[model samples]
Target: MRRSTLFLVAFFSLFILLNSDTRPDSTDTSKSVTQEKVLSHSDKTTTETEHHGAAPSPYMVIPFLLLLLLIAIAPLFFQHFWEHNYHRIAIFLGLIVTTYYATVLNDFVSLKHTLVEYLSFIALLSSLFVASGGILIKVDKKATPIVNTLFLLFGAVISNVIGTTGASMLLIRPFMRMNKDRIKSYHIIFFIFVVSNAGGALTPIGDPPLFLGFLKGVPFFWVVEQVWLIWIIAIALILAIFFMLDMNNKAGAKEDQQYSGKIEFKGLKNLGYLAIIIVSVFLDPAVMSWVPSLDPLPVGIREIIMFGVVFAAYKTADKNVLKANEFDFGPIKEVAYLFVGIFFTMIPALRVIADLAKENSDVFTSSLFYWATGALSSFLDNAPTYLNFMSAAMGKFGFDLNGGAAQTQLFLQNPDAIQYLTAISVGAVFFGAMTYIGNGPNFMVKSIAESAGVRVPTFIEYIIKYSLPILLPVYAVIWFFFFRG
Candidate 1:
């Protein structure tokens, strides 16, 4: 516990040093349109009439539907020798379908914010490395009373900064290796609970929905500030549970086993790659500065820094060291492959929600959309699910009070349109913790755990066992007691 406190204090100090601008700056809310911009007109009659027209988003869905049909047939027609990892394929497709549904409903979100939010999420990985590396500096394999505790704290801290997946990837192996001799090690499960999910609540990169929220409206830093409270509580609970499990195993520990220090961390140069990830995530808005008319100079600068830094990292990383770490393209590749179809397939779902957004105002504020989307995201793809909810909420804004009838004009220009938008942003991001498959890193971590021979829960089994029993209940508490208020 003492070690955990020191590590957390160190992590905070490092976080402040790196993230010099972690402030909750508000967003630009006023809808400023001009003659230069072409826009559809609406009547200020009723809320329904205020719509710009039947959601003009059918164009986006046709491509997605066609693609799905092709995906279904391509494998059969090609007789491709490629191995089909059925579970992975199932989860990937689920995300695509959910995204498509959300897109059709107009619940989609933007891309700019996702980029920036993800950058910070990556940069934070450096801090995890540094902190974990610190413990290795003084590692005494013989007496690791504080190792599990240190890992749990480090996992949570990193979850906030680098994201749950990065933290888990960086720390999980070291954790298992440290306790290799112990026969009673249930630390892995607790590791998954804290290292993988519970701790990653604060920032958007910490969880995908949070990033989606940033894409939608919520300030980047606000999530970290407000979510720290939840992260801390979850961290504490996970640690306590892990301690109990470890203690039970310790009771049956072998007397002859001796401490061994086989694990050593080298390649400080690769540490720079971790930094590149952070810069990329934080400066996403700055990176997109060169897009035609919208020259967000900061985004341009950020993009340059990310590409330049990471490129340098790739050059400097030792092949031997990377091989030792077992760093493969598998995780990122899986994310890329699955998300390709997902990003396109879900446009229809988003468009549909965008069309119905004005009428479903209650869905946003009441958080039915948030919980529902997040829970489903646990098994589906979180990104598309997030976009779906965001698109729907934003659609509500397209309703023009002037286009509505005299009887319903008051509701169209209620001047409170932005509130619902923010609600979608808040709910979707905050609620992604309800299941494992909800986020990209969740399954990746589970796969890693299984590789370690940790006996991970099956997909539906995970939902019924870990998620439904633990996550859903706690999330319910957080919603009604913390978020709803």
Candidate 2:
């Protein structure tokens, strides 16, 4: 791990030294003009010149790419070491890029923004993780194909209400336990596809990417309003496919041998905690809007509320509930450590994309945004990728990145902007199913399945076997019907 970190530092440093603009005078004026043109649209008049000089060169993207490669390859090639040292690696990479930005580029504002974003993002994810861990749903039914499909469908519906992570945590155990005697790998894959990814397309609470969008001024319901049809179609098709596959598999085997029992939900009080988080999500922005004098940040208040609720749930919930669920902090800790690096190193890549969008806004049509965002989100973590494309899309339209409810309203009212936003929303959420690393819950589900003695596919096998043949075609249909049209 140390050798890898040193190699990464040396390589990124050399690359940045050789490629990044060392002098401020070398900054592209055309990019500056484009940036100014976009920021000019803000409701608040800016006396300060927008720092188009901070446009990152393509060289700065190396750290981001290297980080992504580390995430993708390290686990496959160096599983034991990667498992033990991922957090350290993440921190090292983050510091390397941040140091470059601070010393070489003299851009601390970007670093500050990135860090703040990381904190808020991790805080919310942590709160959700803690709170969700307290709830356990026990299943008492036969593992029939139809019943399994119905459970997945139910998971898909509640995914929007409780979030993909929350819903996955609550349901995966029961789903696994119900079919433990007769479960197959395909069942797990389908669960990750429909329950962990596609189901999260309809609401801000459903996915981290959408929640990031919400915090960045997108309306809470805008996701549903824009992509409900796509969500419904995708879920319907996947469920239908699963039903057929299960039926065919079941027909060849003898069933009704596994014992069944009645279903029961434990830690019912956690539901209230979950509701508090959701309500806080919707209401915090409004509260911020009402009381402009709030200190620190309104989001901080929301974070505090969520953390408090999480603590309450953790204390009030029974210990046996967590034991039955086999709950642990490993998944959330992994996400926390990994995403911090993603948020930080991705700063320059996001800036470059935004600058490029400004210079050539016409090139980034709705279709382009959808594919670009989704394709990247397929391998990279979806939350930061979503924010990156969102910034570029906003810059293309000369919209304010920080504009909240009013900007969302304007975006909804404009037909062209609506197309881009909808594309972005659907792409980030739906394509997250393409890979385990695409979303937090994907891997969590995989780990739990493995612990339960189910053989989950490797990264390459999963993509080649399931994602490409199944998800890509569905995405193509969405692109043609929605984005292109």
Which of the numbered candidates is closest to the native, going by highest lDDT?
Answer: 2
In model 1, which regions exceed 4 Å deviation? 1-146, 182-189, 215-217, 250-253, 256-264, 286-315, 350-358, 363-370, 380-436, 483-485
Which 10-residue window of candidate 1 scores lowest in summed lDDT? 39-48
Give the alpha carbon lDDT tens digit for every residue of 231-276 in model 2.
Answer: 8888888888888888877532245454446788878888788778
Error of 2 at 301 (Å): 1.3
lDDT comparing candidate 2 with the true structure: 0.72
Model 2 scores worst on lDDT over the 10 consecutive residues at: 40-49
lDDT of 1 by residue, 307-332 (tens): 55544554556666555545554544
TM-score of each: 0.61, 0.82
Cα deviation at 220, candidate 2, in Å, is 3.6
Q: Where does candidate 2 stray beyond 4 Å? A: 1-53, 215-218, 251-261, 283-287, 290-299, 381-384, 387-404
